[model samples]
Target: MAPNFGRSISFPLTPARSFSKSSRHVRSVSLPGTTSSHPLLANLHAHIAAVRSWIQDTASLQAGLANIHALHAALADLLLLPASVAALRCTTSNTGDRLLDAFLLLADAHQGFQECLLELRQAAAESRTALRRGDAGRLASASSSQRRAEKDLARLAASVSAVSTKCARLNLVAVSGEEAEMAYALVEAAAASAAASAAVFSAAASMSSAVSSCKKTATFIPAFARKSTAPESAEATVERLHALEQCFDECDGACDMVFRSVVQTRVSLLNIMTPTI
Candidate 1:
């Protein structure tokens, strides 16, 4: 869904100028209702205007993105179009796209968001269906499920925390944590993906732009992508990609072992508390 911007945004591609020295030097004959001694009011007004301009610029981009998110959240909440629209309107951002393709990409984000919501809802509904049917066999064994849940929860928490605190804006001279590069790449890719989707829907997406963005995403394809950092600075990105592949392999082996250990620990504790069951 496209977000409606209530007002037109004026991008100030240039710097603000104060009244010229000659204009400032001109003596003001006080208007009948106002004090001539007060120059601060005019300055204050200029400052407010600048602030308002900034906000409008932010709204242009934020409004669209917010609406896109709303569509997904509404899908998860099992709400209709109205709910999604409401959600989108409530969200705000600092700016919109500089290019036509970017705005179209926003449309793509909306579709992806909806897909995410649908997948989440479907998974939850399936779990509920199993519970209602009393089909324990359809689920993981009790101990295994418990352990998996704990491991998953921990991984999720760590992932979220890492995203929130670890990422800083991209800088040519400065770098961040091990996963920071991936996060930056992922964010850019997500934005690009959204843009590409929008272009596909809009019938206006440039094939060249879409292809470039697609390559960025392709670099991160599962099993083939890397997540870990290598010690070398020269060709560090390539090395990191290699490390990430190793991590995925390690993940398959370690994940099972780690979860089993967690289950064993929990079961042992339960056994100590209860008589042999």
Candidate 2:
């Protein structure tokens, strides 16, 4: 059965556009913090705006998972552009190296977050099965697993925040012209995308504890015994478990996308550090 999430998931009406400037129509684009009429930078700003709009519309973890991925993937796409490549090449190797370190931190955190999601999803599914089978011991084990996954997510979120902070501190005072503008854009996107990822991590952690209605009693008593003791109906708890499982599955897919994007961005940064003959 399809998981019923009780409400409609609203997404951006516009078809997801490529972050490549060549794929987008060029116009005289002007944005704050931007100095040049560079087409790639313009596209970057537009993508950032779209992501900001998504965050404003629906910041909930369930609804914003794809947006979180989109923001990071857009950052990677921005780095792949010819203009972005030229800007990176113009900067000192030290600056490029620092940005590369930030991306590595993000990539590590993203990988950990994906593992947490997988564990959470598996625990939620096991919990549902235990509840259905009236197996108190199994339910308790599953609930413990869920809590552990939530804690892992919380820790991973802290790492993501640190990455954002690191990106914000990468000052490029010596860079001028298009390099300066690209530096601004890169740092801005990194901070924003990391913030989005961190917010979702926090949200997902809280959501696991909030919706698992039987968690408090599942450790103590059998599901049948909870008929009078539990605050919510067994049916409802089952539905919530199913929802959590689906949500985690969805987030995991998005997390994988963001992780790959982070890796790609790092590869591009490495390319910048490499000397071309």
The top-ranked prediction according to TM-score is 2
Which one wins on lDDT? Answer: 2
Give the runs in model 1 whose Cα sits over 4 Å from its true position: 1-98, 137-277
lDDT of 2: 0.65
lDDT of 2 by residue, 1-277 (tens): 1121112222133322212223111122122555666666666777666655554433466555666566666676677766566666665534577777777777777777777778888888998888778787898888888877776666655556555556656656666666667767877676666656666666677778786655554445565866675535555788888988897787666677778887887887887669577
Off by more than 4 A, model 2: 1-34, 53-63, 80-83, 90-93, 217-232
lDDT scores for all predictions?
A: 0.27, 0.65
TM-score, one value per model: 0.20, 0.76
lDDT of candidate 1 at residue 35, scale 0 to 100: 24
lDDT of 1 by residue, 1-277 (tens): 2122112222133322221222112111112243222233233223323322332232222233333233222222321223222222222311111112232323333333233223323333333343334444542242233223223222222222222121122231222232222222223322322322222212111211232232234333354333342112213322333332343333333333323332332333233223364
Which clashing pairs does model 1 show? 58-94, 61-95, 61-96, 62-93, 67-88, 105-194, 105-195, 226-244, 227-244
